[model samples]
Target: MGERLAGTVADAREAAPAAPAVLRVIIDAKRFPALGEAPPRHVLGPLRLTLRAHEVLVVTGPSGCGKTTLLNLVAGLDDELDGRIERPGQGRLAYVFQEPRLLPWRTVAQNLALVLPAGPDRAARIAKALAEVGLAEAATTYASRLSLGMARRVALARAFVVEPDLLLLDEPFASLDRATAQRLRLLLLDLLETRRAAALFVTHDLEEAVMLGDRLVVLTASPASVATELPIALDPAARRDEAAVAARTAELRGALRDLGSLP
Candidate 1:
């Protein structure tokens, strides 16, 4: 009986469809201002990047270096850019902006429900996502009543509920107190592990970049291009260790210094 059950499990595993790749490549992509009487101002690109499944690629650069623009292009929010971006046809994308962007009048569950198609299990899915972010009890609370930290968690929960193929984050922790940001970071790491989605995270904070990225991509100022790529070699467990995070942070800083791209 045990042998038969094992064989059945193996057969099911073999019959299951393989997961699709996350993102293909951005080849020689560039973004420029609208063409009019004035000379066009270049915003970003002549850049190239690729992301794989379950990989976290963190982008860091000086302020106004077009990090957000890069993410916009990837998210298909801006197609005016020049170059080629390839994505899997079966993959879905999700974006988490710097702001929570919730409806003031809506409950937390309502805000999350906005993204999902109405189905029998939609409520169950929403409950599970909120629970994952430690917001199980706040499901019925209105957005206006929640604290900033709780609001941010709801935003994250909204994104994860979609089960995206690629997740784009534009400095979601910006302007938060250090303690709050730290807690969110840990929550994000845990969620990322469970979802295993390819992610592109943009941040001005070097520490945040080091903590979240499997590979860090540093960009040049303005009309941005890749300055350097540094791969973090630490184990996943090391990200929770202060010493490990500090060591990786120092290594990244040194690399930025060598490239003269440290902000």
Candidate 2:
């Protein structure tokens, strides 16, 4: 596994055409005004990193490490900054927020329809997406009627409907029960592998990082910065249940301590 990743890294280092079209992020400096009073606070970053076309980059760190802030920049939600972010293709991008930000007024299916491209056969796509998230039965239900986990699944389905080249997920499985969260993790791995979307996922869970990242990027607490990008040493197939999960958790914990992201 180490040899394979080394080869992949070597290939990434090779020079490509002068006008490299791959999705890359080179944040020379990204600063924004702080939220509260007293002092002129800011989420600052001369932060730098890159996410290749087929990478699943997991960002983790101490509380207030600016995880969500970084995700927003990647999502094009925060443009009130100065930096350069090169997107791989002109293809659409999609985001799954921490909350299930579904429109209360619309039925689950209708909410999903809002993001999918206009086409003659969008219903089929919506159905497929809903099924992928195990929400096919909730298609007719109002957003108000679904449980939090179900609602988040709808948010996920909505994001999936876009068929994005880049998918930004911000703690999408954070507030769920273990069973549900695990199910979503498996589903996510399936989605990421099958669809081949370059994804950047932000989470505080060491286990999640271990299970998902091709390389895990750790950050410092608020006013965040990249601390390390450690290679996750586990087969993607070892993503389920106790044994592999526990081992990965141990490895990740040791790594976090070494990086000073954990106590």
Candidate 3:
């Protein structure tokens, strides 16, 4: 009788459906129309990618390879592309652009509040997000007064406060000093650990890519397409080790070299 019951349970599990992808991108092509003396330019070739829940997919490639354009397309900021973007269900999304892009006139708390709907719990939510990013004391600080690093932290807090299902980050660490950038990266990893949201990150830094990405998507030059997809299997704890990260970076560079996509 026990054996029969076990067989029935196994059969039920086998019959269950698999979960759908959080997002799927199938971009056939993207082009810019002629302007004055400039002729039409193709920015992206056929490309396909998918994002699964709690995954961090980093997109990196040569300069002018349409990495930003790809992110914009996935974020639904562009509709001129040839193919379609499939998001399975109605889910909240957030974007942290290259620049902090905070309104200088607003306070840090106010900045986070803009993304959230007004309610009695709004203030508490803002406080919790700020605290997670180590900016609890900066709640009332004006965006204009905070330094670049602080501003980036505030932007990150804003993205997380809404509890997005998908988070899109475009070079969030660009232009910061190494120490500051490292700090922010670590903070981001910690937050993602707790939140477990699917993230699509774009960056030019190989080291940063090696440290944060679960999978790296390398693209070809202008009129970009997928050159290769490299899965990074380094243990999460190893991401902090210089030797581990350097080894992985070297491996990635070699892969790019083989594809002739190295920048």
Candidate 4:
């Protein structure tokens, strides 16, 4: 009986489909042009990374390590760099910046509607997204009136409303208070689990990276490259455990310190 069960499990594993590759980034080099008397600033590369569907890859590095530049490259906001980014088909990409980046004059629902296509179901989509982020009643509220935490929630709602294939988060929870940030992190985890979208999240917080990433990539100092890539084995429930998260964070920090990537 035990042998039969083991064979069944192995067969199931073999039958399961592999996760599709969602994004491929190959950057041979990235440099900022010289200004007047200064030389060109070498910022990043010789970096290659892949993001797969239903995966969250968090990138952590020292300050001024060109992390944001990498995001810009992936988003196609800057195409002058040495390498190329490849994505399967024309998939929608959503981004949540450090700042809310909402239009102060527009209501929360209107802000979301801007990204969504004009359709009869747009209102429903907006409402559902707002509710998912715990902001149901704030749909009609103007972005200018929201507190910092609330505004960040709206930003998240806006991102998810589009049903993106890939999500890019750049320190989305950075400036919030501890409690608020924790709440947002939980909310984000729930959304990611439900949506199963690929994500590339960037942050300096080691704990946040440990709690949220399916895999974590550590980068070097200026002209950043991959220092190490650590696959997180923690389940979703384990991520919510403060002690577990802290231990993982410490371990990651130690590895980075050993490599001289972190101080």
Model 1 per-residue lDDT tens digits across residues 196-224: 88899998888887778888888888788
Over 4 Å off in model 1, which ranges? Answer: 1-21, 25-29, 32-39
lDDT tens per residue, model 3, 117-154: 99999999999999999999999999999999999999
lDDT of 3 at 28: 89
* Residue pairs in clash, model 3: none
In model 1, what are the clashing residue pairs, if there are any?
A: none
How many clashes does each candidate structure show, in the order listed? 0, 0, 0, 0
Clashes of 4: 0
Model 2 misplacement above 4 A = 1-22, 34-38
Checking candidate 2 for backbone clashes, the offending pairs are none
What TM-score do all the candidates reach, one by one?
0.87, 0.87, 0.90, 0.91
**Ranking of predictions according to TM-score:** 4, 3, 1, 2
Output the TM-score of candidate 2: 0.87
Question: Of models 1 and 3, which has the larger lDDT?
Answer: 3
Name the TM-score of candidate 4: 0.91
Best candidate according to lDDT: 4
Best by TM-score: 4
lDDT of each: 0.86, 0.79, 0.90, 0.91
Candidate 4 per-residue lDDT over residues 42-139, each given as its tens digit: 89998999998989999988889898899988998898889889997658899998799999999999999999999999999999999999899998
